[model samples]
Target chain A: MSTRTPGTDDGSAPLLTLLPSTPGGAAAPAPERADAARNRRRILDAAARIVAEKGPDAVTMNQVAHASGIGVGTVYRRFGDVSQLLWALLDDRERQFQEAYMSGPPPLGPGAPADERLDAFLDALVDRVAEQRALLLAAHSAAPRARYHSGAYQVMHTHVAMLVSRLRPDADPALLAHLLLAPFSPDLMHHLSVEQALPAERVKAGVRELLALRDRPRPA
Target chain B: MSTRTPGTDDGSAPLLTLLPSTPGGAAAPAPERADAARNRRRILDAAARIVAEKGPDAVTMNQVAHASGIGVGTVYRRFGDVSQLLWALLDDRERQFQEAYMSGPPPLGPGAPADERLDAFLDALVDRVAEQRALLLAAHSAAPRARYHSGAYQVMHTHVAMLVSRLRPDADPALLAHLLLAPFSPDLMHHLSVEQALPAERVKAGVRELLALRDRPRPA
Candidate 1:
């Protein structure tokens, strides 16, 4: 197996580093000029609002520029294109989510048993995917294979693997984590939530049921 | 929720019916001329050989035609393009696999317990994916989300769901089947076996370990 971390090898640093806060909630490597940072924040915030209101397909550079009261050229300059802007929006949300899971509180973060934490994380993941379903499905469609190597997926895998290691010391935690996380793929989730019209609550419950399968007796 | 069987609703009848044996091992709806059937078998065999030796990328119309001793124009006339030919190959292999799990004797088919059948199906599935890794990856790249709705996926889902329903009467078998099948997605399997360089036996063992989780006691 490659010693390199899963997502670090992928060329996502440029996009990941665009925001002020890193995914680990570490300090920025270098402080951006206050005004430039403000413009970036404004632009990303505007784009996020547009995505929330009308879905990612409805987002446009002009609309974000107008919404943020920034020039269209500035929006173009900062994010390069609509795709990059949307990715930045995803990165932004991802950073916050990482913070919450890594350190925010009990269960999802710290101060809880590994099993409870695993449950909390999977539940939160369903919500996280739901919150950004449109963007995630778009990103997944754009590069299906990239998900396994992407920064976000790597982090999730590492975290889940850690919990599995603690909970089931005898199992292969890394491989098990990957399998556990498979059910949360954006495409599968989209089929369950949008195409099948399954409620998020039901989906979450189903996740718990899968976890509960651990307790079932082996078939004789 | 959809009253339809998963694979039947997908528009795969034309490609699937191209072969004499239906996925169910039932008689073909219509028979082809003897020479045409012979030609079709020759073409597919030649293509499969090329793919096995040189991978899907090396397959070409002229190459298959030359190898099969069929006219290039006939190859194109029967299968419109390289992409269609690949899909036909996949459908062909899928038909055989479907027969094995659906009707073939013993653990994978009719004679074993539901849990053992599920395990056999998953192990066989891992081999099936590995056998067609390059072709499956190419098809997946062409359309990622389509996997959920594809005829092959639907059939696998239906079969797995049936096993789950038999084993866990209290669980939502349909949803659990989808989740269990999620780990076998082509892209992820490619990542594991090709990129990660994990052996097929190891992957199979990992899958068995995942299923074994059902027998593990719940965490306190």
Candidate 2:
């Protein structure tokens, strides 16, 4: 947990911050905390490396500790379980994405046309999936609960639903929400990317075509 | 297995009934023929009774045997396995439906506008799912191999893909096939019907609205 400082939009707080920890040196920990912060960063960075290299399922607390050059007890102290560690990794990624889309200019955020925003959102989503391709696959194949009810999934549904509502006010917003997220679904993405060996660009193209076809008018 | 008389449909051989042998039939052995047939009839009747009373999961082989005053091995010999038994029961129901939809009348089968066929197919599908509601639920909760690769699913997809192609020659027929079937997926249906407690008619109406929305022209 990161600590919170007032008027800071840097997206971090100190240890025990509600969201993510602020990385600045302004509110440096007054307690025996500088070492802990360093340890936490080391653990997270090591976890990410292990996840990227060996996939999420292959990552164990002992492995993270070994990779981070810390005692196994420290890894357990940082993240209580493998599930929590995996979740934290995904949450951090999703939070960064949401901040980008919400505050960044044009297409993904609020400065561009709804149509383009929809397209850009789809592209960003597919790219994110591609980047975390290995971890996402491992998590899902492990259990339905691991995949379905994660905070990342909830955030995605909520974010996509908001965008769909903004973009297509006349549509069945909830169903549209489902449709928008459908392409990024685990099963569909895995089928396209890994199984079909399709390039990410192709999936993005299909998304464009789906949007066009879905929005097309009926024959007279 | 029921034996089909060769070329009966082509008028080269006389039609012969192919259902499981009943009592006083020529296929029966002389000793204990009447008793065996009677027990078989009793067992099937009890199986149906148990399913109707307590749903598909409750119609276990042991239960069926006990209900019919027979041994468990008798149940096993008759059905081979629970999956086979379940498939047999559902196949009996599905044959009636396939016959009706393939050759019966307008709207559902042929002789109607292509759009009407699409609409009627959805209505019939929802109705069938609702009619066999318990069995459908049981099947989904069962093993994946038993649930997903059933011949029924293949037949439905093929039937739907064929019809949608005819209806929308300019459309991406395969994608439309998925879109059309979206409203009837077991997960979707269960989510709408059970979790949401939505009226089946209202769900059907919503589906109709969705199709209309899909068919509407895009904003230029």
lDDT of 1 by residue, A32-138 (tens): 89999999999999988878887776666777788999998888888776766777788888888888999999989999999889889999999999999988887
Q: How close is candidate 2 to the true structure, as a TM-score?
A: 0.65
Candidate 1 collision pairs: none
User: Could you give the CAPRI-style class of model 1?
Assistant: acceptable
TM-score of chain A of 2: 0.73
Clashes of each: 0, 18
Judging by DockQ against the true structure, name the best candidate.
1
Candidates' chain B TM-scores in the order shown: 0.82, 0.67
Model 1 reproduces a share of the real contacts of: 0.49
True contacts kept of 2: 0.04
TM-score of each: 0.83, 0.65
Give the top-scoring candidate (TM-score).
1
